[model samples]
Target: MTEPVSISLTVNGATHDLVVAPRKTLADVLREDLGLTGTHVGCEHGVCGACTILIDGAPARACLTYAVQMEGHELTTIEAVAKSGELTPLQRALTQVHGLQCGFCTPGIVLTFEVWLRDNPDPDEAGVREALSGNICRCTGYQNIVKAVLAAAAEMRRGAGA
Candidate 1:
């Protein structure tokens, strides 16, 4: 067995020090070591995008990334997307548009759209659909998800978002 490596990184605005096996995926470290279970494991590989998280403001699949490689990096999970106890424009829009059903994939969708919205704050429906192609949600059939993203884009453009 390989020795566990120690890492210190910021998660959701908090610093964490953890020791994990070298082969431990970032998804495992988030869900197990850090007690942040928002990142889910679907395929265990990077294909499903179920374990998406933001690393230094870029969307990354936590399941495919190693915990040891994240040392000193800034990570944000679904838990941190909302600030000051307020839902983000996307979250609010999702609720308004019924973007989620089972919610198993909502965390990944949220983080994915969070990153997408940063660059495409005025996204059209087609643009939103293209941006969400990576996140696979079994429920909602992606119609409402696309609607929510476009709606959120409008809300964000109206100055309801950061």
Candidate 2:
């Protein structure tokens, strides 16, 4: 058998050096080796966006991206989004708006929209829905998610202008 490939990458602000198979996806490395289960794997086909993560400050598909390719890259998972056991404004907005139900897809939605929110802190409802099209949610029918995004956006805008 071939030897495992050595990879060095930063995850959630922590440096990690792991020996992983070349075929191992970023999701596997994050969940299995790094003990970060927040990045879930749903379709595993890159369509679900359940394994979405921030690579170099951009949203990426962890399931479709191999770990070997992530060398020297910085990854941001769901755990990183929450600081000191406190939810971010966006996360809190999600809760306030009741955006999540089963919570299986919440992480992906959070990570995915987080990038968009940062890039566009003041987005309309249609824009928010368009940005969220990549992430699928079976519960709440996405109306609550849209509400949460809009609320968070409005809050952030107010803060930025203040």
Candidate 3:
């Protein structure tokens, strides 16, 4: 048995002081310790983007990260996306366009593009496709997902102007 290590993790703008095994992945710590299950675990090998989350404002696979390694970093999960109980533009667009089916990959896709859209407020279809390449969806064929991303980008740009 490994010794439990105490670490502080700031997730979703909240700081959590927890004692977890050193080898425990950030995904487990978030879901099990912090009850933030929005960060899903798919492949556990980092190939699938299902466990994607933001680490210091960048998308990273929570399953590939150790909880202890995130001591000083700011983590953002799917739970933080719609914090105000209202859907984000991306969320709304996804729903309106039917971008998801099983929804197992929705959180990761949403988290990935949430940050992506911030940097790329005016992305084209190719850019959106490249950005979405990391996430794998067995349900939707990615047509609607692409449309939703483009729609969200347009909507966000308009909102920013307002």
Q: What TM-score do all the candidates reach, one by one?
A: 0.95, 0.95, 0.97
Per-residue lDDT of 17-69 in model 1, one digit per residue for the tens?
Answer: 88889999999989988889989999887877889999999999999999989
Supply candidate 3's per-residue lDDT for 122: 97
Model 1 clash pairs are none
Count steric clashes of candidate 1.
0
Ranking by lDDT: 3, 2, 1
- Number of the top candidate by lDDT? 3
Please identify which of the two predictions, 1 or 3, would achieve the higher lDDT against the true structure: 3
Between prediction 2 and prediction 3, the one with superior TM-score is 3
Each prediction's whole-model lDDT (CA) = 0.89, 0.90, 0.95
Better candidate by TM-score, 1 or 2: 2
Provide the global lDDT of candidate 1 against the true structure.
0.89
How close to the true structure is residue 128 of candidate 2, measured as C-alpha lDDT?
A: 93
- Candidate 3 structure quality by residue, lDDT tens digits, 1-162: 599999999998999999999999999999999999999999999887999999999999999999999999999999988889999999999999999999999999999999999999999999999999999999999999999999999999999993
Per-residue C-alpha lDDT of model 2 across residues 48-155, encoded as one tens digit per residue: 888999999999999999999988888999988877897777899999989999998999999988889988887899999899999989888999999999999888
Q: Highest TM-score, which number?
A: 3
